[model samples]
Target: MSFFVRLSLVLALLLAGGCASLSQQQRDQAQGIAVAARSTEVNCDRADRCALDSPLRALGGQAMAESTAQAPRHYATILDEGELSLVARLNLIRSATRSVDLQTYIFDTDDSARMVIDELLAAAARGVKVRVLIDQLSAISDVHMLSALSGAHANFELRVYNPTFGKAKLNYLDYAGSVLCCFRRFNQRMHNKLLVIDDVLGVVGGRNYQDDYYDWDREYNFRDRDVIVAGPEVREMAANFQAFWVARRSVPAERLNDVGKALLRGGVPALPEASFLHPERIEWVDEEAADPDFINQAFVATALPVQSVSYVADLPRKHRRERAEEPLAGQHLTEPRLDALIASAQSEVLLQTPYLVLSKPAQKLFKNLRKRDQPPRVVVSTNSLAATDNPIVYALSYKYKRRNLRELGFNIYEYKPFPLDAPIDYRQLLPPALDGLPPVPERNRMIGGSAAGSNVRGSGSGRKPSVNGSEVERDVLRTETRPSFLGTRAVNRPLPVTRKGARMGLHAKSMVVDRRIAVIGTHNFDPRSENYNTEGAVIIDDPRFAEALAQSILRDVHPDNSWVVAPRQKPPVLSGLNYSIGKASEALPVLDFWPWRYATDYEFKPGPDCPQPLRRQDPGFHACYSAVGDFPEVDVGPKWLLVRMLTAFGAGLVPIL
Candidate 1:
């Protein structure tokens, strides 16, 4: 074993040895959750009435009413606009007078998180019952600090799923013990992102609650997508929120330390005596909302509905230890439901996900599609090695992803990092609200502007660029065509000074099938999502929404935004007979040669001949280029070797990626 690997294992064992049981106070506080949540019951189970009309009824109710009447389900695709997504969530909280339920995997303690949290607090202040359920690990130290505030309000409740054992200041110790002790169950987690307000509207997609999710982050911004739904389907969506909210594994905020009887009664800072424990609420202000806020755009534009809308989610017990031996049947439903959705596709299947480790069903589907008389066209867009946040997963998933899938006749496109100066057309993803808005110099909209050009109308989506699908884009990924590799040069333009450098990575996961159905969710189309962690999505049987989603996926994979995953000879075998023997001695993960590297004799600016870093710097996308132009280059590293070693150690568990 490598020295570092042995050292890490030893450290984990040492930390696990220090494991301690919960204190009596902690146990008592955990019991307090039942007493606390009773103040306003979460009654989504009742078929008769899931939720009563809130102040939103006074705001967007009429539009929502008109929208449902015209369609089976109302939906809108949130393109690359992070600001607008933040605005949408803010508006949902702003307009909601009744209740808000937010469930997310990662809620970072960044500006975007602050905005969302403060808004939820304000909503609670206004008597809108607020419920937030975040994964225990992803809830960073700052978010963990809110336990006292949860003790402050009955209307506002915070729950952590799969609470970790270690309270070590650094937090790393907790992950080590948790994963080591109950490795399988602990490994399974909730990966869904949802926000349901008053049980009438919900936002579902791949984006999480962090700066990267909102595009405000300087270092990295996801070219992600989300959908806002306003109609009958939300009732089921709200039920999904309730499923996770009240699960057995969830712990109330009061179950934590720094929480006591005093903070419980104080509510938000808006209430007298609440200032000391909860200071964020002091600066909170409730503004009168614009009538046709950005959310209005969804109901207004996606009025034409489809045959049906189904909000499907895995059961809460997906990760339950007590039920680990139970049949997978009732424990998980998302994957099966996802399969049913895929089976319904007829002519074409357009998939966009950040991770793509083909599950058995996925492979079978591709095989069948390839054999069909006149098979439906299938195109997939996912993160290339350089752009992925999880290179470990990329290494595990990339082996033969193209060769195998392409041999089955599926075309694949890998997302390229956006140039610091790329212009994303906002109207294509959002409503017309962004159409005419003048460039805000403070926000730097012109250079990477989604809100660009004179004709600000949301129309003309067809006019936008589709660089990844272009022939030149294909040539870059096609390994057969030899090109001259050349020296590195500084990109023609300078990177901006946006407080933090910009990063453009793909996190959007959605699919449009035959222009007849749309499936949007957090499912990554990987084994991890399939057999392990839970996931959720909203499947809409509507042509208009599907087409719009289809167009969006096409635009994202365009050469300007992505690189084609054309065919290539197998990647070279691992070097050194010992290393090869060692790898083959155990289970190897992805064995496919990575086709993303520049071809031999590659001629291009900032070309392949230049030395590339094992890790790309923030906004470091300029290192690689193609015939068309330069974009961010994929970042790979020694970590790939480390991940392989770790995966081999885990053996049976490693495929969870």
Candidate 2:
């Protein structure tokens, strides 16, 4: 046998010979001690979760009370701003009266995550039953932290979804071993971002529990989105959470190898008090959330009464081909919801995602849509090479530029790293009381961080010019690289050189169809979301909500914020020959070395000659837009080579990426 085959056999046996299951006596002893420790921490006298006074919660209650069976009215609000999104979640957690259920893909050890956890613990102290379900790969990796949380409160519980190697955390070697042994099962993840409070209100969308998702990351932040829903529809959201919670893959903290060992050893103290690097900044946000006027203006005013809303989600065991007959294991719900929405498109489909690589089913749907006589205009708002966090996925997108444009009939707009008009609050990046002052020099600021006791370091004191004539922070230009972990290495790999500072990648996953339906959720519209990950979404069928969602997506596609993808201006001589060669190169599975692609990035000129953005097919498009090369604003570096290499050789990664 070859060396590779022998190695695979050894790894497979190691995987099959899993860790011995803990004895019932051991589990009972740990549970008894943890419950005894938790009993002393009870702080509330009321049984009703000691619910706080919240006008937002009260408004939701009134809507639920007034809602009818036939009409089924729901109060739906779009959370486009990161600050507002965080505030909404905080307020809801504070006001929970019965239970708080949170399911997420990432629960990072950042300050923002600490704030949310602090609130959840407080809710538990007040008699609320709190359950947190997180993916093992991206959840809190600190074993001591997990042990502390294991005994924090009797009312609070945490579970890791799909723990590989039966451990709470996977090291580098374990990750590699899993790939060699059980790639399919290990590759599956729980990508749902959901929070249900009192089974009455729920928030679902793409925002994860991380600083970047909430615009608190000074180095980088995500231009993401979420939605809040209340009334009859929230029941469905709660049901979906319960389904995943009871699923076999949801392993309790005390059941995992690392966390269980710590629990068995005892002396695991309760979770530490929340410590924030910028407590004053968090205080300001808390004060804003508490302010009745701010809550009414930011959330209540924006909420609309929608007649139709539904929650759709994929089951926990989403990729069980052998058990395909089982409804809970084999069925894919989120994909069908998306497919049905796109299939019903009459005039247009506006999609916004960080990655543009489409699954085969998605490709077929769009391709069929293009076969219509006057097909609906398909516009995609996605990340460019300069802005994207996952260049590997972007490479696959780059490889299929011709198909996405000429065949799928998509009008693609790539988001800029530092958009001029994104709805981000940069004030949060500053330390307390320094909001209005000039940018602080690196040597002067020394903030401490929570994760790994790492200090919040600053970039060098240098500035660089950006593509949009703005000064970028010196740090944005620097590349940060690490070993590939699962598929995330591809995501967190070093970004190509770009203008300095405050980079924003598109993380919002949404779709607006025909200005009558809108979807906001965790589905990336890619193969990972389609097959490997269990996803969730909220579909609203109200014209007003759809129009609002459409406008939000359009704002991201504005000339100041994104670059248009269009066919490059062909040479007057041998244009036909050039097209033929490019097409032939694109058709290859590997070694597609043609340099000149049919489509390239275009920057909109904002003079009287060209006052607004135009589609590529428009006759006056060339006059108004100038070609800015294929990967505009991206410096030629290792990342540039990586994209080309992956485009030529990464075809096998399409389904997994």
Best by TM-score: 2
Q: CA lDDT of each candidate?
A: 0.55, 0.78
lDDT (Cα) of model 2? 0.78
Summing lDDT over every window of 10 consecutive residues in candidate 2, give the lowest-scoring window.
448-457
List TM-scores for all candidates, in order: 0.70, 0.90
Off by over 4 Å in 2: 1-28, 323-330, 430-491
Candidate 1 versus truth, CA RMSD in Å, comes to 11.3
| CA shift of 580, model 2, Å | 1.8
For 1-657, candidate 1 gives per-residue lDDT tens digits of: 999999888876756553654577655754474345334543244432323233333333543565545564353444345555665677677667577899988876555576677777666656678899887545544433554445445678778776655221224444455555655655567788899877777888887887657654434457777777666677788888888888887766555433333234442222222222123211221221233532344233333344567888887877754544666647778888777666666788888887666766677867877787887778888876556665555544444343344456656666654433223333222223423444434321222423211111233222332222111101111110011112111111112222222435677778888888888888887778887667998887777667767776776665555665432232476334433443344334434232242211111234365444211111433334333311234222454444444334433433666
| Per-structure clash totals for the candidates | 24, 1
User: Best candidate per lDDT, number?
Assistant: 2
* Candidate 1 local lDDT, residue 382: 80
